[model samples]
Structures are given as C-alpha cells and as structure tokens.
Target: MTTLRIGNASGFFGDRFSAFAEMVEAGVDVITGDYLAELTMLILARQKAKDPERGYASTFLSQLTEQLHTIAGSQARVVVNAGGMNPAGLAEAIRTAAHEAGLEIPVAHIDGDDLTDRANTLGLGTPLAANAYLGGFGITEALRAGARIVVTGRVTDAALVTGPAAWFHNWAREDYDQLAAAMAAGHVIECGMQATGGNFSFFTEIPDLRRPGFPIAEIEADGSCVITKPAGTSGAVTAETVVSQLLYEVSGARYAGPDATVRLDTITVTDLGDDRVRLDGVRGEAPPPELKVSITEIGGFRQEITAYLTGLDAEAKADLVQAQFAHALELSGLPRPHNMEWTLARTDRADANVQEEASARLSLVARDRDPKTVGRQFANLLVEFALGTVPGFFVAAPPGEASVYGRFRPGKVSQSEPIHRTHHDDETSLTIPAPTEFRGLEPTSLDAHSPAPANGRTSAPAGSQTPAPAHRSGTTDVTLPLGRLFGGRSGDKGGTANIGLWARTEAAWQWLRSELTHDALRRLLPEFADAALDRVELPNLRAVNFVVHGALGEGVAYGARFDPQAKGVAEWLRSRSITVDADIAGSVNLDDFFTAEHTPASASSGSDAAAGES
Candidate 1:
C-alpha cells in the first residue's frame, strides 16, 4: 500500500499560516488549507473592485511564499480556495514564486467560474450579485498542469482534496458513479482537519490544540479514505467522532451541487481496517441545467436590546410585566413581541427569590427595507417598557445600533458557464516547480455582471416606500424564507429559505385573516379567498395552494417568479403581529428551522417544502 501524508494549515483565510508549516513538519502527505467562509464570497467581490486585474483573492499566494524553499517535498501540497474570486491570479503567482526559488515546477490554472460578465445584464434585468460554485474539474486540470501548490476560486469545499486525489489516481470522468463516490470522500474531509478530530466537540479530553496538525485522506480507488490526523497530535480517531461531524455538517431535505442533488441518506460508514473507516453509498441526482447565482438586495435593519431581569419570582414578574407593556404597545397601535430570549448565566449566586436572574433580550423582526423604522420603533418601545412588568422584561436596545442586512435570492447568470473542476488522482506523478512567469492573467467573475459598485461613498440605495395606504385595494401576501430562498442548496452555504413553515390547518388561515387582508386576497386570489376562502378546506396545511388568480407575486403563481404585486403581498403577509416560533432545526449540521409551530393549533409546524410566507 502506498502511504500518503496530507495536512491542512489554516482554518479560514484569516487563520494562522503556522498550522500548514506544522503539518508539513508532521509529515502529512498533502497540506490542504481551508480559508473560505459562507460570507467570504461577498468579501472577495469587494476586493475585486479595487484591483480588477489582481481580482479579489490574494491570500494563498502570499501565504505560500512565506513557507517556500523551507518546505521540503515529502509530497506535501497546498490546496486552498483562498484565491477567492481570483484563482488564476493565485495560480500564476504560485508559479512565479516557484520560479524565484529556482524550481522548474509546472503550475495549473483551473479557470472557469468568474461569472461577472453577465452580472451587469442578465435575467430580464435584475442584476446578478455573487456568482460562484465549488468550481468542479478545475482542480483536476490544475493537477494535469503539474501544479505543486493548487489554488482555486470557490470550488466545492470538499473537492479541494477529493479532486486532487481523483486526478492523481487518474479517476475517469466518464465514471460519475465512482467520481461521486470519490467526491463524497472529499466532502467528509473538506473541512480540513475537522474530519480527523481537530474540531470534534465530543472529546473526553484534548491535547496540544494550539498546534494541532491538519487532516489526511488516503483515498483509495474504491471511494474511501483513512480518516487520520497528523502524527504526534493529541486527538482520537473513532467511529463516533467522524460520523457525528458528518451528520452535523450536512442538513435539510436537499443537498444541491454542480453535478447532482445529493441525498445524505445514501451515506453509510463502517469501521473496516484498523484506524480506518470506510465511507461509501453517497448518491447524487443530475445538477440543475441552470447555475444559480445569489442576488442580494438592500433589505433594511433589525434592532435588539438585552436586559437582565432576575429576582424573586422572575418568570412570573417577567411574564406579568411583559403583558403590561405589550398591552400598552397594542393600545398605542404598536407591535408587541412575545418572548425575550433569556439565557441563564452565573448560576444562583446573585438572585433574590428566583436565584436565577437570567438575562433576556427583546428584538424587533422588522419587514420594511428601512433601518430608521426599526431603530425608531425599538427606541420608543425600550423607553416605554424598560422598567415595567410586561414590556419592562427587557432593556438595552441598541439605541441606534442599526445596520443594513442584505436579502439574497438565486437567479442564473449563464447556462452552464465553463468551469474547470480539477482533482488529484494519485501522488506518485505529482511534481513542484520553482516559480515561473505567469503574466496576462486577469481576474474576472464567473457571475453574469458587475454587482452594484460598492467602492463609491454612497450609502445603501435609498429604499422606496410607496404608500399603498394600509387597508387599500390590494391583497396581502407573505413570503417565508424557506428552501432555496434562504440559500439552501447543497454545499452552497447555510440558510434554507424556510424550506419549512406552513400552517397545519386551512381554517387556521382565518385566524390569520384579521391581520390578513382576506377580503382583498379574495379579489386577488381566486381559489382560496376571492373564490370562497371560507369554504376552502385545507389538508395538513402543508401549503396554502393559493389560487390567488393574480396574488403570490405576479403571473408566477405556477412557478417561483417575482412581480411587484408578489413582493407587496410577501411584505404584507410575512407578519402582521409580533410572534416567536419554535426552533424546529433538525440535528443535521447547522441548517435552520422555524421554531414557531403553534399558531392556530391545527398546523404540524413542519413542512419539507419552502412556503411563500406564513
């Protein structure tokens, strides 16, 4: 058996470089560096503005230079997407560094995702904001280029290791079933050393965490890799830890990828060889024909304030006083929230009767696209209820600490823009070169067009607030951030657009009607309201099946389309009152689920599909 040593240095782009060096020192077969975050794409987009040619990402090249000549070739390679928006530039830079070190190494550039060209003018007119996918096959090409250190832009986070392993082992592209198997192995190992106990939280004890080495995946042609950490490290490799991590990182009903909509249920784990567990049974559906780009728009702001409310009968007093304040606010024609997030801290040492004075926070879940509205309303609420029983249950609202939050959606920039996904198949044939001259490379976005220029000193575009005049001649609609709307695509990032959140009862919508424009909805919606909502019998409340004739958004009642009316309806129906939901988020990794399942007492509180709004 050929043994390969692999390691990862940095946890993120802003992480320490010493980790990689330590891994090299520890004799890892390959050094994999993970430096991208869910929000890193936005950061790279910003960086590209300042130096279009340099593009957005430059961390990997600089970091690699720091360890150059010092790193001996024990088959230790650097794989990272710290290249961000500019993988080609980083690849070129790596070659240059190798040349400076007098090494005649071949460098590979896996170029294909900068979808920036169509960003300015695609999809009917709305602009494309951020465009990137775990660029597939690019890493394999880079392996083909003989790159000692490979850098790429937003490739599938897992493929950083899997692709290279596949390329070196010469895995066949025609063999997708096996390719997917290898890809699954990469997915397990992508989070750097996370697979090998570096970040496992269930450990009974940990050792030398400060200098923990990276992970290694000695993947075989059969689609399994030994889940091992660097030698001389203080970590345990067991069946429990790895499986737990796998279960934790993946969640939701669907996991979208460039090639397939993979189902996590297909995965299985077995403790086969000594200290080596076999990972197999990962299956994938063919990828969507159109690539999705996340388009973020200026939504508005949210304000929150925290307060410590403890003493004798804290819950009783908090609940009573909270009611007082809420009643007062309701009378004043203002919204009153139900729950104050209370976190218990410091034990029972300092409380009077309760002996548990937990700190509670009251937050505003605003709908308007204006920060000022949230800021002002929160400030007013704080003053009126800061010290009383009901509303006085919380205080410390951020007076004016309001900032803009971006609302994101998906749209296509191109029809399968050429993406070079590179993976390593074997290690024996890999070689490194002294940096060489790599010029004429320019950073371009795989997205369709340039996002709204952010370099200008202009603040967020002023929001448009057309006074529809409440109780006007329009029906109300609600949009819940379920499924894809919440960025819930596999390997995409966290945030599934609600992907859940539907009423359990059809009649339950009636209780929602006082706050909802059932009358107007009747005119706009033909099937439910306008068509006799009173008689519309709902099943499990899985979905409203709004036959609004013209409601929902536009003529897109059939498909997911956005019309001004739909936007208005969405904003209208999101919420007419302040409420808190239960956290139904499953045990599958870090995905989110709506917590409030008890609205009308007839809903199941959970739906697998994404709903428009509650």
Candidate 2:
C-alpha cells in the first residue's frame, strides 16, 4: 500500500466525545487521538494519587465501548496517547473491554516514559508527574507484532501518525527526510478540528463551522501528504487553515522532536480544490540526543473574587474597597496572603443604557501555600465588607474555597536514559533500541534586519552576520486592521506565547516583510513592550512568526494572565490597526482571502513560485 489514511479524533482530553465514532465511520485506514497537555498531566496525577488504576484517560475506554464492533469489523487500526501516565493499566482495561464485548481484539501498549520515581535520582526535582517524550519505533514494534490497537504513555503527539507510517512503509531511522515529512503531517492533524476550522482566525470566511469535522492525513510512502476531512463535513479545508495549524504553538524553524527535527521553513502548502491542501517538500534532520521531559507539580492554593463597581467614581470605588479589605483582614487576625493581585477593569460607560454596561470589574486574586490563607477564611473576610463597603458594591458570585494549582517545567534526559518498551498481546515484551547516531541542534536565533534570499528561504543560521534594514521609498498607505490582508494563529508553549501572521499574496508578503518589525510589534502590543521577543520569517509561506518570552509567567496551570493559554494572542495582534501600502491592500479581497481557492491575480506574480526554492 503506497498511501495510508489516518484520521484524528481528539485534540485534547475533553475534546468532542463523538469524534471517535465519526472518524471510524469515515472509512480511514487508521484512527489516532491525542489527550494530553501540560495541565492534563497534572490532572491525571491527581487521579492516580486517588486510585492507582485510574491515571489514564477514561473517556477513551467509553469511546472504545461504543465503537469496538465497528472497529473490529474494519481494517482500520486505533492508536492514541490516551494512555497518558499509565499505558499498561489502560491496555489492561482495553483487553477487559474487548473480552466483555465478545471481540477478540489484540491490544498492545508502549511504556517506560514515566520517570516520577527516578526524578530526584536523575537530579530532576520531585514532581507530581514526570514523563519523558519517546519516539515512534516502539509503536512500530507493537504493530509489527500483530497488535491492532496500540496505546502509549507520553509519546510525542506526532508519534501516533509517524509510527503507523513507519510500520506500513518499513522506514528506517536513517530516512530523516521521510520521517520529517510524516512529522509535519502529524503536527497538522494532531490538533483535530483546529486543522479543519475550529478556532480559526478567519472563521467568518468558512461557510459552515457549526460542527467542524476532524482532519485526515493521506500519507504516501515518500512522506508527503494531503490534509483533508470527511466528505460533506461541516468545515472546509483550505490553504489558510493548513497554514494556521502548521504555525500553531511552534517556535523557530527547527521544530525538534524525539524522532526527527523538521525544517518548518522548507514545507510548501498548495490548496487543492474540494477541501484538500497538499503539504510537500518538508525536510528533516537527525534526532536530538536529549528527549524533553514535562515535570508538573502543585504550585500552591489560589482563590479569587470579581466584584462589580456600578456607576460613578469607578477608580475611587476600587481604591476604597482595597483599603477597607486590607484593614478588615488585619482586624480579623488572619495572616495576609503571600501574593495578592488586584486588577480593576474600566469597562463602564459614562452614559450607558443598562446597569451592566455602566459597571466596571474589580478582581482580586490571592495565592499562598497555606490553604486556610486563601480558603473559607479568606472568603468570609471578603464577604464581611459586602454591607459596609462602597455603594453598589457586589461580587459577581459568592466567593469559593481555594483550589490547588499546578506548575509546569520542562526538563531534559538523555535519549538512552528511558527504556523504550512495548508489551505485546501474547504476554511478551520487546525493548526498542535508542538511536546510535545523534545530532546537536544549535539554539535558533534570527536577525530581523536580514533580508530573505531571492529563493525565499528566510531562516538564517544562529549567530549569522546581520545587516542594516533596507529602506524602501514612498507608497500610498491606508490604515486598517492587520487582519484585512493577513491571517494569524497564536498558541502557548509553556510560559512563552507564539503568534504567527501570514499573508495571502506575494504583494502583501512584500509589505509585511518590510513592515511589522520587532519595534513595530512592541508599539502594537504594549503588554509585551518590555518582554523579550524573537521574530522569524518564512517567506515561502508568506508568513512571519513572533515568540513572546515570559508572556505567561509559569504556564497555563499557573493562571499568570487572564488568557492563561494565550490562544487569542494572535487575534489580538491581527486586531491592531496599521498603515499598509494601499496597492497591496487593494490587491487582496478581504472576504475572499481565506475562502478563495487560488491566489488573486493582482497580488501574486510568476516569481512567487520561486520564493522558497533552494
């Protein structure tokens, strides 16, 4: 078989519950699901602590129960990272479910990613859950041993697709280019509907996003693939959708993974009609010597209250409440919280139609190691001022007890440190060997002033010589939202946030490359003015990406910012108004930029094809 059809069902732990059945019925050769995130690991750790056999994703079993017969009757195989922290345990549950369903399905599982017990010994601090990322070979071993269903604990998300591709194609470790292509394809579909139309920036352009279908990758033996979805599905796949997902949560050009490092700048996206996008020419390099490990631990307890200040004197009301609350806490004999953050949002209007429109919000968040410091005692203290405080002062809701929050930190372990093992259905174990050859990747850094080569390769080697910015002369400019001519995608990577902006046409690309510099970005998003920012250009895709360091103080679970995951950061950037060349803006049809099948003639030239050529 030269091509394999792999469909993704789940993006995160709580994704659509019916996606599994939907994909299985769509007639794909394989089905894969991803159910882990930094926050998810912490949740699973808590579950396992309560009951040892409950660490894995229980939703996977429920979905399997409903689709076991349909899957057993078809040639399609199932693979997922739903095994989470307990692949062995989930595998056992799957076997029991198969027996109860009167189906003789063979189940296999890959393990040895968990490193919580040996964390301290390895010089990694004690964490609630510590798992090293493994590669695809272990999944290959299980499939080759005749297992129809495979489960793994903490493998790279791409491994779900790359393993199946490797098994069907019989690829060797040395085939870096092929592996890299598969890795790129995997990354695109791994987030399920995000590749279809869900969370898309230009959602208004998509005809029907009511119920977006999960994405499917048609992978060929050579590693290139076409991204599409089930026929007649609600969502439509276009070049813009694929491009958005390709840039989601990524940093720099070298996308390092356990299997191989993919050159993000090398991939080319072509829009094929009827909701299909082809991704080709992706290049890959040797796997890094170290595997990334996610270490999650309980940070502390936190409690918060949001009070509404209605009508006049909003700022003065806010100040008075803060003073009263502090004095009251001192009188109550309760120790002050270690950290107290107050934010007063001036959302009130001077002459509004309703009370809600004329009210501002005052939010106070308290965090401390002692639960009592931020628990019922804290709530009682805050409520005491409800009657004695400023007029028209009432909280959004009654204060609740403190809840524990988790902290996520990244660690690294030697590729050989974790024993990659696969347990077969026939009660046998196989140990997969680590890659003997290793390559160290240089830290990625790009100079914004460096011009992209004519062939369109925008990535430069680290510490490369820099040149002064090229000054271009006069053009008619118009002020509008950046979204008028561009689409953006943003996501969180631990504490850092990445925003990727792409233009639909070469003319827009030319304007974007000259404009939107690092200083220009600081002026647009003042929140990151003092934060360290790294900008990378991908001219082949007509795109530029920015990474904002420390944007999220300690990752999602820490709740450092209002939008903890930073999913909307790109949309925020696109909403900013900027002056752009009127000719470039006129060349793009704002309504058709994302919906059209082909690039507009006015925007692209014959030279566009050679932009990224080597």
Candidate number achieving the greatest lDDT relative to the actual structure: 2
Candidate lDDT scores, in order, read 0.45, 0.84
Q: Ten-residue segment with the worst summed lDDT in candidate 2?
A: 461-470
- At residue 269, what lDDT does model 2 achieve? 77
Question: What would the per-residue lDDT of candidate 2 be over residues 1-614, giving only the tens digit for each residue?
Answer: 68999999999999999999999989999899999999998999899989999899999999988999998998889999999988889999999999998999989999989999999998789899899999999988898898999999999989999999999899998888889899999999999999999888889989999999999999998899999999988987888899999889987767788888887777777777698888877778788999999999999999888899999999999999999888888898898899999999888999999999999999888899999899977877768878988999888878788999888888999999998999987889999988887777664433232222344222333222222223347666677788888899998888888999998776777777777776667667767766677787776467888888888977899998888999988888888777766677688754444333544332232123223321
Residue-wise C-alpha lDDT for candidate 1, range 1-614, written one tens digit per residue: 44343455665666655666666667655667777654555556555666765653566567667777755344556667777777666766776787888865555544455556655555523322355564345566565666666776665666676566666667654444455555565665566555556544333344445544455666666555566666566555544345534533332323445544443334445544334555554544444445556543343454444445544444565455546645665677754332223232223234344423333332333333455545566446556655544433545444554554444454553334534444332332322221121111111111011122244211222221111223323444332322211111011123221111223123323323222232433322222232222112121222222223222211111112223123233223332222212121111222111112222233222221112110
Against the hidden true structure, what lDDT does model 2 obtain?
0.84
Candidate 1 TM-score over all chains jointly: 0.58
Model 1 / residue 439 / CA error / Å: 40
Off by over 4 Å in 2: 443-475, 589-614
